[model samples]
Structure formats: structure tokens, C-alpha cells
Target: MSGIKIIVITFLLCLFIINSICKNDICINKSNGFYADYTSLNCQTFYFCFNETLNKTLQCLNSSEPIFSTYRQRCIGVNPLYDECYLVNINENHENCAWFSVQLSTTSNLTYHYSCLYPFLFDLESKGCKHYSQVQCNQRFEPKDACDYHHPQIHSSIDERPCWLIPSCRNKTNGFHGNQLQECSSYYECKDERFLNLTTCPKNMHFSDKSKTCLITLSNCENSTKF
Candidate 1:
């Protein structure tokens, strides 16, 4: 190949990888060539390898062709198989939620719209709502706020007020307590036996007894001991 062609090839490859190898070499055992970093943003960004080594990480942000199209071997605005983020441009409404009415070439008159639920965002590859933190999308959406609660028996005596009051807090100056009646959802932060408020975890989330904070849960962990 000509020198100019080789340079072009190298530059295109650089779009996949750079000279700086990341500390966490995600490409340590790969064969070679372009590969997407599916760990977080799906394939909006990717890496290139040669001889089982990761070179650098590159992205497909802020461009007409904003997505790495592995099938086409380059960046493209849209691919029926894996993209909807760019379609976001067609609609000026930039809330975390949106509706897409794309008319695909192969499928005539087939238009569909989508709305991403809270704590989740629209994923181009999956063409569905995925947790925002896990997918690389063009917009931002806030997660649902934690639910609110009042002491079940604010009128009752401090020592026996609620079903889940920690017996330990009565003697201490300040501490946190969990609600067994509303297990994995509600808790209290008390200054001695008197305190301000009762808090609940966000939708579907759980409270961690060890940390006194709301957290994502995958199992019936009644309480999270891990921070």
C-alpha cells in the first residue's frame, strides 16, 4: 500500500485505540483489531489491539457519525441493528424521556416511540430502556426520589414506638435504626431517642443496616452489610 494509505489506516485505527494503554487493560487477552468497551457505555466507544495488547481507548461522541458501527467497520449515525441515540437529534425535546418515530427503510410505515423510565435511559443497541449509568446515551435522566415516611407511632413512647426500633439507640446519644415492619425499605436516624425523620429507599431499592443508606438490591438481602 502507498504511504498515504497506510497513514489513513493508522489514523482510522487510532479512532479505536491510542498509544496510552489504560491501567485496567481490558484488552489483555484479545486477539487483535477493534473491540467495543461494553463494560459501561456499550459500544459508543471502543479499543484497538495488536498482539494481545490494549493500546488506547477512543470514543464516538459529538460527531455526525457518533456510534461505532462494528458491522460497517466505522462510525455511523444510525444502524437498525444497534442505534437510536442519534435519532434523539430529530426531536428537540431533551428530557431524559423521549419518543422516537423512525421510519426504517426496509420496513415501510413502521414507526415506534419509546419512553425511558426513571433510573433508566434509552439504549441504542438494545433499543430499550437500560439503567442510565450502565448505558451511553445522549441525555440525562434522574432516578426516582426515595419514598418518605413518618414514625408509625410518633405518639407512642420512645422505647416501644415502632416495630423495628433498635434497642441499642435508647441508651446511645445518636444512631440509626431499621424498620422490620417495612424491611429493606425504611430506617431512622436518631439523636438519642428523639430525632427528625423517617426515610425510605427509592423504588425497588433497599436499605442497608450496616451503612444506614439506600442501595440497589438483587436478592432478598433484607439488609446490606456491605458498604
Candidate 2:
């Protein structure tokens, strides 16, 4: 063979070998039969193998609504001391609740039974209490105010009233210098403190020779003008 043809044949053989190894490493076996690629949607990472009798019980429950109730009594017969068995309602709105039961039971001993009554099933995990009637997938707790009693406060807005202090006279009054009241509402000293200027002072009012402070005196000048 020519040197160029030999090089091309060698490259083709190498490419074929790499492709074969890639195909073998990616194959995954799903429970529903077909061998799928690892990245395929049908191939899940987790698997569980229940008892054959339990598997048959679940299969019967999945088929019909009435069979779930009938299987519950039969389940108790299989294990009278069964700790958990729940009856759940299977309506259009309560479909997610049914799915939740199936998902939770994958790792737990809880068995879901279907019913037409107000409470569809008794949850064995919750001490035979009824599961939530309806499941809201994205339901969230949004309280109106920060002081609401039910939900725990996780975060708060900086603009909220409880987080800031409002400017007011009650927090402003500091002390009196001679007869003049020297009041301050802030933490910093006022630079331009003068009579009738209305300067905002800090905790300590700036006093320049005490005369700059204002005095509130009782006025009787109308009766005794000359005095």
C-alpha cells in the first residue's frame, strides 16, 4: 500500500475504536425496559426494589380508585402491626398530593390509599393523620407585616419602620443651659448654632457664651409697658 493510503486507514481505525468505547460507557438500564444513554430523561439515578407482594399491592392501587381502599384492609391483613397506612383523596386538584405520597413512600414505609371522602387517606408516617388535601407546588408564606405572629421573620427591608428612627422632639431634647432650652436631635454637633437660626444640633447643643440659646418667658408687657 502507498504510505499516504496507509496513514488514512490507520486514522479511520483509531476513530472507530474511540466511538465504540464511548457508546459502551454511556449505556444505562432503566427499570421500564429499554437501555438508554446515561443522559437520557428516562434513566433515573435512584432505584428501589420492594417486596413482590408490596409491588403487586401498589400495582393494584395504581389501576383503580376503589382497589386502594380494598388493598388497605388487605395490607393490614398482610401485616396487622403495620405502622403506617394513609388514605388520600384523588381529585383533579389533589393529584399532586397523590404524587407526593408516591415520592415520599419511595424511601419510607408509608402506603397511600385513595378515597372519595373529605380526607382521602390516613398517613402512617404522621401517626395515621390525613395528608394535606391539596398540594400547592409553589405556595409560599408572605406575611403582610414584619410583626405577624404565624411565620418566623427571616429578613427585613431597610425602609421598614422598625429598622430606622424617625426625627422627632421626644428624642431631640437634651438639656437646658441657664434659662434657655438647648435641645439636639442628632449625634453630631451643630457648626452654625445662633439665635433664631433653627440649627439642628447633636446630643449636646453647641453653647457659645450661653446668650445664643433661646429663653421662653411669660409676657405681661401689655399691662405694664414701662417696666
Candidate 3:
């Protein structure tokens, strides 16, 4: 019985090895005859083919998976000969595609095979080259005699009027004064009589009479004594 158990274990192990070999062979066969050329731009290289099946497969591979097979199903059964493939060359410096690729592999049903020749889709902007129109706009912003005056100065102060009076006192009125007052002056009396009655006068002004008149001493009043 022990010898029989050993034989059974060996048979299962052999079957597992055969299954693995067949799977690898299938992958190898699928990779054969598929070729892509990567064109680099802005330090990134990309490949594009109009074949729908290949395109769909690549799109699925690019996305996060667990849904990879479901995504792959969108294009896998289509004829490979008629399908196009797009491979975006990842920019090492940019890291956007690299991170995306890692996530895609982790989450998807597709595995990266080093033997496969993945192509790149060329994008001029990604290659560090600017379009002609963009170059023109960049030139317009450069220093030029025609635009020197038109370009606003970097540092400018608003033409602010001097604050001649405190903001709160601008509309307030001066209060009446009795005789023995040294001089007549303008004072800030709040429109609300209660505020005038309750609030103390500011340092530069003084309350003259009980009626809410505040006084600013002025030397030019005609009746200086009645101020």
C-alpha cells in the first residue's frame, strides 16, 4: 500500500509538470509572429496598431485587473491579424506609466512575458517636443520691444487716497459747545444718539456738553471762548 501511495504521488507530480509545460508552450505560440516597433517621444516611446483585438487586449492589460479576463474578453476572440495593438513606452522619469503598468499587471489576468516584443505609441508632447503652435505662443511671451510697455510692471501700489480722517468718524458730526470753551473744533458724533451717549470720545477729541457733540480744538474759530 505504501509503494502504491508513492507511485500515485509521482504520477500527480508528473501531471502537474506536463500541465505547466503545455501552458508555457501555448503562451510561446501566441507570442510568435507578433511584433511591434516602439517610437520614442519626450523620452517616452509608444506603439500603435489599428487591430481591434490587439487594441482591446492592450487596453484591458493597461487597466487594473481581477477584471482582466473580463476586460480581455472584449477583444481576445477577435481575429489577431485584423486587430491593432498600442503600446505606450513608459517614461522612467515620469513614472506615470510605470506605476500604471505595475498596477495593471497586479490587478489583471495578463502576465508580462519578457520574450514578447511590446511596441510603443509615439506622442510628440511625451517626447519633449513642442508643437509648432505652442512654440509660437511661447515666443510671444518672450521679451519684445512692442510688448515692453504693454506688459504690466511686476510691482505696483494702488493709488490710495490718504486717510484724512478715521473711517468711523468720516460721517460723524461735531457737538455744541458752551462758553469758556477754548476753541471750536469738528467732532465725531455717531448718528445713533445712544452710541454717542454711551461711548467715550477718542483721544484727539473731547466731549464738550451733555448733548452728543464731540469737539476738536481749532485755533481758527471766530468765537474761541464759546467753543
Candidate 4:
């Protein structure tokens, strides 16, 4: 192909990829008005489209309000749950809501911790961390497991990465491997070092990485203690 034609094709391909993905692209087929970009665990990025063309792509950065609310159709106040939650200065005795981050290989949101500082808790109304005494949000004494934020079924229109991209099971010759982001209850059994079979534990049992088996006893999975 001629160089000019090749360049044109490359550009078109990029656009196609963008439209296929959610985070970087939202101008699919004459989109007019604002649309949310489902990226990095939240619908933050804003896109302005009209007549099958994207006019602007905006970000909620360098401002107090960074979270984009689709209901409001605009950026809102400061979001304490903006990114990864961390324990910078924690009080060992204090009961606080701590969060753990879980990375998904195929999801747009790699992971984000949503815990407030030591003395404060995440306040939904204020849209930021505030004194725990004033906020009615649920409080936990300890941070939940990373798997708590994950779900076994990823019902997304976007394409998921190949099995090779999965770090835990990529090189496994055989045996079950737990997916931390998909909760510990579900796991993938690797076979012949090249195939994967999705497996879930029997009801009331969760997969256990420590013992490499499912058991009726509680395991460190989402709400396992409840069972």
C-alpha cells in the first residue's frame, strides 16, 4: 500500500479502537451531548459529541470537584473516594472505614482505595472525608479484603484481555489459581499450561488459596463471615 494510504488506514484504525474502548473513546455513531467515560473505576471523563463527531474531551482535574455525575450531568464536589485509599496516619484503636484496592486485568478501573484519613470517614453527602461523628456512612474497624470490590462476572461490552495476560495463572502448568480481583470464592483451574476453566465453589463454601480447596468453613472472601 502507498504510504499515504497506510497513514490514513492507521488513523482510522485508531479511531475504531477508541470507539471500541470506553475510557478513551465515547463518540460512537453521532453522539450528541455529554457522555461518561467509564475509566479507572469511575465515570469521570466527559465527552462532548455532536453528529457523529467528538468536539471535546474533558477531565475533572486541578479543581475541587473531580467526580463526574451522570445524574447531575456535571462535575460535583470533591470526592474523597477519587482514587486509591491509603492509611497515611492511622490510629490503631480507632474504628475507621478502610479500603483495599483490587486490580482487574481487563477492567478499566485498575483499583482504587476509598478510605478516609485516620480521624475521618467517607461522607457521601459532603462528597469528601469528614469527621466520623457527623457522617452516617457505615464504618468498619478494619479494611476489607481486596476481593471485596470485585465480582466474578464482568458484564462489560469491552473486550477482555487474553488468558496469557493474567499474571497468577499465566505460567501455571496445572491446578487452580485464585483471582484476587474476582473475589477468592471463584478461581480458574489451569490445565496443560495453556487452558483455563472457570470454577466456583459450592454454595456456602469459598475457594481458599491457603489450602487450595473449597471448604464449608469461612474463608477470606467477600462476606464469607456471613456464611
Candidate 5:
């Protein structure tokens, strides 16, 4: 065969090999949009093709997973801390409400946290992120395993109450019961009608009033304790 004929045959063979591999391993097609529902079997590699041409090869970073966004026409990382949640309008129609779970370190302990995309809240009961109106907002303390804020400021007197972040304490009426003291947890209570008081956790530790326990930090209270 002539040199030109041999070159043409080689080119055709290369094209056939590439087409076969793409057809078997990827979901991209001629009619595919900017992005396609294509992920590697390893779940850590993905690709973005433009105009039927492989444009980019992206690898998942850290603990993030690689995903393709049909709306964005690209590859993205589903990072817990930096992931964006899609927002639903006030009407609460059928929409995607994606959320990410993040691990955060407080002064005392390591805690797992979840953030819903805009206008959504993480539902503990459902174990899923849902629309704000759909979720039944907990008006009470979280379970003992969760991390919650502890107020550390010193009050002027026993009559003066500090403010914590739990919902039950916020709803309690000041001086409703005798001495107006409702123990939310061993380390915290509702006092002075509208105020919350921390009994054990110091300024440096996070308090879990539900378990009546205090999370200790290296800076101040070096050990977790119960009052």
C-alpha cells in the first residue's frame, strides 16, 4: 500500500478504537448537553465533554465526591463545607434541596454538622435536608451526641440569667414555676422567666444541657465533667 493509504487506514483504526471505548465506558452521546450523567466506576473520576469532544478530566479532591451537574454543564465536587444547596421558592414546589454534612471542631469537641441549601433546614427526625416549611422545627434540645452552644458570660446575680441557643429555654416564661427554674439539662436551666443559665460548662467549653454535661477544651477546663 502507498504511504498515504497506510496513513488513512491507521487514522481510521484509531478513531474506531476511541469510539468503541467511549461508547462502552461513558454515557456521552452526540445529543448530550454541556454535561452528562457520566461517572467512573471508582466514583472518584469524571469528565466533561463539549461538542462530543472530551474537554476535561477532573478528579475528586480530599473526601469530596465527583459529580456532574446537568444544569451547570460541568463537573463539580460535592464538598460538605463548601457545597451549595439549591433553594426552593416560598411556594415549596418539587425542587432539589441538596445538603452537605460537615465536621466542625469547637473549642472542646469534634461535631458533625449539616447545612441545607438556602431556605431549608436539616431535619433530625427525617435524617434528611428538607424545605423550611416542611420541617417540624424542634422546639427542644438536640440529642446528647450533638454539639450545642454554651453561654459563658458571668451574670450579675442568681436572678440574672444568661442566654443559650436551645429553643425550649427561649420559649420558657420567666418566673413561671416556683423559683422559675426549669432544668433543661444538668448543666443548663431556664431561669428568671426568659433567660437560660449554664451550671457546669465554663466559658471555654460547649455545654450539653440535655445530658447535663460539659465538653472540655484544652484552654480552660481540660476535662469533661458533670455537675
Candidate 6:
């Protein structure tokens, strides 16, 4: 084979490999809401663009009213958890008395169930209430100048209170800071967005997506698979 022809073939092979590796689907540009997957019409999910990371997890906020919005990539009109009653609690006897059942399961002897009160999401892993998105908060209650008992203190326009009331450590310098939160001996870093130590959890412990804390329990970290 001629040297020039060999070079051309090698370049084409490299291009093909690059295309296969970097599959930046155009659907990534869609807004941070529920969108119907073109490949699977019946499956509607949400997407979140955190900086350059495209989190394509199918988080169906409202499973009951699973209606796609007419406007754009939005899913349902609003998150149903925040509509009426808020505060889901299971008694010691494994009795749930919440308006909606966020999670329900049963073991050999004990039954486990988690419920979400208004504006709070029932985190199945943590078995507690986690703060919902700002858009979800706005659905039922308007932004208030003064913080209320149920609502978290509004530090800034972009601040949405995370679960477990862990402070958003984005204020620190644009680098890594170890063990910022004294409660959990986990590392913290500041970038485009700031949260908790997500890179690694303590020995025999795992990070919780609902609370954003290092939990000794393994089941709590199921949803936080990336970390």
C-alpha cells in the first residue's frame, strides 16, 4: 500500500474512534426538566447540567401525574409532594401516617415506609425529608423576604437549602478544603457549584445523596452511585 494512502486510512480510523468515545448527544442542551427520550417515547425523565457534567438521570418528580408539559422539557405542572400536607413520619411500630407514601417496603418482621411532607422530599435511603428544588418550592409557596420555620433562610438568590442543613460551602476559595463541616470528617471543595465532600466517604461509610453526609449505612448510598 502507498504511504499516503496508509496515513489517510489511519486518520479515518482515529476519527471513528473519537466519535464513538465522545457521544455528545444534542439532547444534552435541553433545559433542566423532564424530557421524553426520543429513543424511548414512554420513558420520560429529567436532565440536570451541572457545569459541564450532564446528569441524565430519569428523576420522575411526579409519578402520579406523569404528563409531559406542552411548553418544553418540563415534566408535570408541579411536584405533588408540596401541594397539601407536609411532614411524613413513621412510628416505632412501623406505622406511616403521611398524606403520601414516598417509599414503602416490608421485611420479614418489620415494615419500612417513608413519607414526604410539603416542600420536603422523602429520601428513601436516609429515611428523612430532603429539601426540594427551588422551582419546586416556588410551586406552592412564593419567595418570602423573611424566612419561615418550614422554609430555609434565603442566603442568596441561587441558594437552595440542601438536605441535613449542611451549609453550601461554595463561598470558600476556588479549590479544595478538607473536612469543612465539623459534623462529618469528609472533604469539601469549591467549584462552579458547592456542596459536601462527594469524592470519597470515610472507611466503611458511604455518602448519602439525600443528606449529603457520610453515612455508615451502605443502603443509603445506593442512589449516589457516582460517588
Local distance difference test, candidate 6: 0.38
Residues 1-227, candidate 6, lDDT per residue (tens digit)?
69999999999999998864543452333333233433333334444443334555464557664544312234554444321112233331122211123221222223223233333333334333334342223223321111221322222222344444433443344444334343234445444334433355668764454565677864553221111
Q: lDDT of all predictions, in order shown?
A: 0.47, 0.27, 0.28, 0.48, 0.37, 0.38
Instruction: Give TM per candidate.
Output: 0.25, 0.17, 0.18, 0.24, 0.21, 0.27
User: lDDT at 15 for candidate 2?
Assistant: 97
Model 4 / residue 62 / CA error / Å:
4.7
Model 5 root-mean-square deviation: 19.3
Q: Worst 10-residue stretch by lDDT in candidate 5? A: 143-152
- Inter-residue clash pairs, candidate 1: none
Tens-digit lDDT track of model 5 for 1-227? 69999999999999999976875444333222233333344334555555456666665555544554432333566644432222221221122222233323321223233333323344545444444455554553322211122212211212122322322333443322111122222243444222243353445554432333544522222223222
**What is the overall TM-score of model 1 with all chains considered together?**
0.25
lDDT, candidate 3, 1-227, per-residue tens: 99999999999999999965643443221211222221221112122223211221123232222121211222232332222233323222121111111112222333221100111111223332111222222212221111121212212212122222222222224443322222323433333111121244455665465443556643323322210
Q: For candidate 6, which ten residues in a row score worst on lDDT?
A: 143-152
Evaluation by lDDT, superior candidate among 2 and 3:
3
Off by over 4 Å in 5: 1-112, 140-227
User: Candidate 1, residues 52-136: lDDT per residue as tens digits?
Assistant: 5777668888667767743234566755544533232222123443222343333443443333322334455544444444556
Candidate 1 backbone overlaps, count: 0
Candidate 6 clash pair list: 86-117, 86-118, 87-117
- Which residue ranges in model 3 land beyond 4 Å of their true spot? 32-65, 69-227
Clashes of 5: 6
State the lDDT of candidate 2 residue by residue for 1-227, as single tens digits: 69999999999999999976654433222111122122322222212212211111122222222121221222122233332222233222122222222212233444333321211222333322132332232332211111221112223222345411222222222332221232222122111121112343433343332343422323211211000
